[model samples]
Target: MTALGLVHPGHGAEDDYPRIEQLLGSDIRVDLVHTDLGEEPRRAEALRAAGLAERLTAGVEELRLAGAEAVVWASAGGSFSHGWEGAQQQVRDLARAAGMPASSTSFGFVHAVREVGARRVAVGTAYPPRVAELFADFLRAGGVEVVAVRDGGDPPADGVAGWGEERVLALARDADRPEAEAVLLPDTALHTVSCLPELEKELGKPVLTAAQVTVWEALRLVDRRVHAPRLGTLFTREPVVQV
Candidate 1:
């Protein structure tokens, strides 16, 4: 069995695995470890800037205890908050603590974009403009050009969690840029797995979200091959091997 670890911000959007499992047709196990984002009206800056290494390590340790082979920090704003280098170090440290390879949703976007051979890309997020820009910078640091970005302002965390598929698809469609080869929706709080296939068809390009990329990266880390037609380019594309 392939066990993947997830550290979610809250109860929001934690159900992404079942959809992926449904698409991949069983045989994959998901182990989710949740952490509270504290209270509502939370500031992305504060969460990003806080010293979360201990908390993250604790969460990964729990996953390791549960037999997780790989761990993914499932929050975009949390990792993007520390900037690119900071986010990289956060994952590195978590892996050291857990004695397993680790990654985050923010980095997963970069990997998924590269996996699909996308250069110029558009970003859609349910965060404030400031938070969204941080994500753009994170992608830029990884050598992916951000051609466009759309923000959903500061909706209540729960409200974002409950965002309907129509609204998510509309935001993704609006954020799609002519110059972009793919559109990236970078929030695990948003339910995106269900909309990826239709969104890809509507936009005529690859559409990837946090939850989907998170699963893809975790599977790659464990050296497992997973292909699902409905998950779009990230799934359909072959994994590249680096010597």
Candidate 2:
């Protein structure tokens, strides 16, 4: 059985993994290592920026020790805090440290966009406009067009993490642009897996969110392919799919 390692941000999203595992079917084992980035609402941004690489590497090492075949940084904004090149280097460094391939949720978004054959894309976020703009720039650097964006202000990062499914789904549906081929909701903190089928059906286009794509990318790295029909285009795409 293939083992995939996940380095998650905090305590809340642990319940989401079993569903991801079930969606992936029986060929893989997921080993998760939790790292608390602290809960100080006032220091969220500064903490996210400063602690990303350190947290990522620490989690990677732990997973490696636990016999994980691959490591995935399960936080979207975390690796992305360092910007585009920094994001790439972060993964490279993690991979080197872990003696295995490494990836992040931000990289997963990049991969998912290409997996679904999307070029022009629109993004929506529960982050501030400034934080969301960082994602926009990252996508631009990866050669994808960011047609439009909607930020739900800088809701306290913890509050944003605790956002309910209905509000999260509504924000995604409303932020989708008709002109764009795909919609990207780039927040790992938000719960998105349960709403993907509904979102894709309504949008009539691929909907790529952080958690879903991160799992997809992690599975691919370990040579596992999951055909979870309800999870939309990202999960349904073959492992050989480009990007």
Candidate 3:
């Protein structure tokens, strides 16, 4: 079995891992461990805290014991809020702590974009304008062009975890453009595993969602790939062996 560990921030949408593990078939195991977010709002200071090396490492031993071959910091908001270089250091610290290959959702989006052969992408995020821009800048630092960035507005009355298919599709539609080679949805807090097929169909292009890319990124760290056609284009492609 290929076990991938995810260090998530606080609560919301962690269940996407199990759903993806099932979709990836019987051989893949997704072990998730959440770090405390305390009373912090979903802004820069709080997000920076969320990706702190110490907080992320607290769950490393648990995941390592669970047979995790690789670990990923699974919160895009937290990682991107650290900026590109800081996020890189965060994962470096995590790798040392977990004693394995490590990455995060911010790098997941960047690497997933390249895996799909897309150089230009449009971002569709549940974060407000400011937070969404951080993601765009993060993408830029990875050499991917941000053709556009669309905010999904305030969280729903029930929050991002409660965002259904229609709301998710709308965000993709609002963000997609003719110039974009792919559309990126970068909030792991939003549940997107179920609607990946629909999002790609509606956009008629590749759609990379946070939950999906987080798993893909973790697997990529260990040079693993699973055939999950229902998950969308990233999964359907052959694995790119890392050098």
Candidate 4:
């Protein structure tokens, strides 16, 4: 089995890992190691702190013991809030600490977009407008055009993690544009695994979610790909090899 480790921030949609593992079949394993988000509101600075190399390093041994072949920093907000250069360094530090290939949801989205042959994309996120812009900027740095950025305004009473299918679909539609080749949902806290097919169908385009890309990114670091069409266009396509 190819085990992929995920360093998740706080408590939210971390459960998506197991759900995705089940979908990818018994040949793959997803091991989740939760880290602290620190005692700050979900803002750029706060997310930056939550994604510090130390926080990620704290979870390395657990994943190593779980036989993880690769690791991903599973929070989009946590990584994107650091901007492009900083997020790149963040993953580099993580890879050094884990002694394996490492990536983050921010890079995952960027790679997944290219892997699916998409250039222009839109951002559909539950993050505040400020945080959403960071994600757009990060994408731009990765050479993907950000056609639009639509914030989902505020989270539900139970927070983003409690968001259901209807909210997720609305967020995608709000960010989608006629020229955009895909829609990116960047909040890891939002639950999206169960509605990936519905999302792509509703948008009539590729819908890349945090949980989905995180898993795909982890798999990519290890140079492995699995057949899981129900996950969305990203999964339906083979991993793009960097020549």
- Candidate 2's error at 4, in angstroms? 0.6
lDDT of each: 0.82, 0.77, 0.88, 0.88
lDDT of 4 at 72: 94
Clashing residue pairs for model 3: none
Candidate 1 stretches greater than 4 Å from native: 40-42, 49-51, 156-158, 240-243
Kindly list the per-residue Cα lDDT of model 1 for residues 156-182, writing each as its tens digit.
545777888898988898899899999
For each of the candidates, the C-alpha root-mean-square deviation to the true structure, in angstroms, is 2.1, 2.4, 1.9, 1.7
The all-Cα superposition gives candidate 1 an RMSD in Å to the true structure of 2.1
| Cα lDDT of model 4 by residue, 75-176, tens digit | 888898898999989999999999889999999999999998888998887777777788888899999999899875553456788878898888888889
Backbone N/Cα/C clashes per model: 0, 0, 0, 0
- Minimum summed lDDT over a 10-residue window in model 3 is located at 37-46
Task: In model 2, state the lDDT of residue 72.
Answer: 84
Models ranked on TM-score: 4, 3, 1, 2
The lowest-lDDT stretch of 10 consecutive residues in candidate 2 is: 41-50
Residue 9, candidate 4: C-alpha displacement in angstroms: 0.2
Number of clashes found in candidate 2? 0
2 or 3, greater by TM-score: 3
